[model samples]
Target: MTEVLFYHLQNMALESVLPPLLEKSLERGWRVVVQSTSEERADALDAHLWTYRDDSFLPHATWRVADAADQPIILAIEEGNPNRAQVRFLVDSAAVPADADGYERMVLVFNGDDADALAAARAAWTDCKARGFTATYWQTDERGRWQRKN
Candidate 1:
């Protein structure tokens, strides 16, 4: 069964929160696929991944890039997993793919301040549960740390 994690972004932006989570996934030797709502969003994240930290590097490529299959991390606006990623990240109202069970884990990150995002996240949470996925919700605390809400 796939494990689903929902991240309710409050104090910090997705840029601040995503890198650390990606790092943890990489540490576990898991390839990752980041899904964005649009090509523009995926392009922005592709650039952010390279410069998020001056001292660190997260090797990743956009789906349009030539060597996508060779990358451990892939950024795409679609649902395909060209990199054989074990983890899939859905952000900015990206829809969860119907074939999501292929991945070991699925993560949904939404800004709490956005009413549309909040509603979509809630629907995704409920849908995941109905699909028999083990779902977990995480929220940012006062110190900007993640804590499981349920």
Candidate 2:
């Protein structure tokens, strides 16, 4: 069973929060896939990943680009994983299919301020629980660090 992680974004934007998680995953030798609801979102994330921090480098590519399998991180609007990622990050309420065995873990990041996003996350969490996947809820602390809520 795939581990489902729900990140409730309260104090920061997705761009601000994503890089560190990606970095940690890379440190663990896990290739990553970031999925969004549209091409524009994926493109924006692809651009952001390049310049998110001046000191660090995240080698990533959009799905439309060539040599996708060579990238450590692949951003896409589609569900396909070209990089053979071990972990997946689903942003902006991106839907997760019923069978998610391709990846070892799935991370769902949803904005707390957006009602629709929260609702979708809630629904996904419930579905994941019903499907017998191990689900965890994480929220930011006062210092803006992630703390497991449930």
Candidate 3:
């Protein structure tokens, strides 16, 4: 069974939140594919992940790269998993991919401030549950700690 997680971002930006999660995923030896809504956003995330922190380094490439299969992380706008990742991250309001069941986990990170994103996340949660996934919801507390809501 696939474990689906819904991360609800309140005052924080995706740029601030995503790198740490990706790091954790890598620490667990899981290859990742982060899907965005557009090529521009994917490009921006590709750049941000490189310099998100001075001490941190995320080995990644866009899906367009010839050696994408060699990267641990791949940023893409489309649905295919180029790196044979065990985990897939849906960001920037990207919808859940059709191949969601292929991964060990599927993470949907949505901006709480954006109405469309919030609605989309809700819909995705319902869809995941209906698909028989073990769905969990998380929200940040006052000090920026993740608290499981359900």
Candidate 4:
């Protein structure tokens, strides 16, 4: 199955998502990869998700292009939010590209708020689509698992 997720992080709370998402994904035998728009954002993600800076997600997030073949990868978008404890805590305002060689499977996890963040993620998604990879912007609609541009 091919997938690309651009869900909204309403309030920047790990409790808001992460746990259930990661648990469910990993259980399904998927390898995860994370990408941050900036080094600071990557660091913050490390501080928040990995509980340490030298962890898998932490290091992978910094990589300009990360390929996790035979594994699921998560590219965490770093929107500059001040309050780390809450969502909407996007501190910096620029979004960088997350591109690299090798591998074709990816799930771009990003906050749906900030225009910049959305733009950056969209670019990556577009790249995914261009590369002939199964790509789509997904969200929960009235039913479930909505993927299609409207």
Give candidate 4 regions above 4 Å deviation: 8-15, 50-104, 141-150
- Model 1 clash pairs are none
List candidate 3 stretches off by more than 4 Å.
Answer: none
Error (Å) of candidate 1 at residue 32 is: 0.3
Flag regions of model 1 displaced more than 4 Å. Answer: none
For candidate 1, the 10 contiguous residues with the lowest summed lDDT are 141-150
Model 2: which residue pairs collide?
Answer: none
The TM-score values for the models, in the order shown, are 0.97, 0.96, 0.98, 0.50
lDDT values of the candidates?
0.92, 0.90, 0.93, 0.44
Point out the higher-scoring one by TM-score: 1 or 3: 3
What's each prediction's clash count?
Answer: 0, 0, 0, 18
Q: Provide the lowest-lDDT 10-residue window in model 2.
A: 95-104
When sorted by TM-score, best at the front, the candidate numbers are 3, 1, 2, 4
- In terms of lDDT, the best-performing candidate is 3
lDDT of 2 by residue, 1-150 (tens): 799999999857999999999999999999999999998888889889889999999988888778999999989887888998999999999988644666789999999999999999999988888888899999988988889985
The alpha-carbon RMSD values of the candidates against the true structure, listed in the order shown, are 0.8, 1.0, 0.7, 9.5
What is the per-residue lDDT of model 1 for residues 66-93, given as tens digits with 9 covering 90 to 100? 8899999999998898999999999999
Off by over 4 Å in 2: none
The positional error of residue 138 in candidate 3, measured at the CA in angstroms, is 0.3
**Residues 1-150, candidate 3, lDDT per residue (tens digit)?**
899999999999999999999999999999999999998899899889999999978899999999999999999999998999999999988988889999999999999999999999999998998999999999998989999995
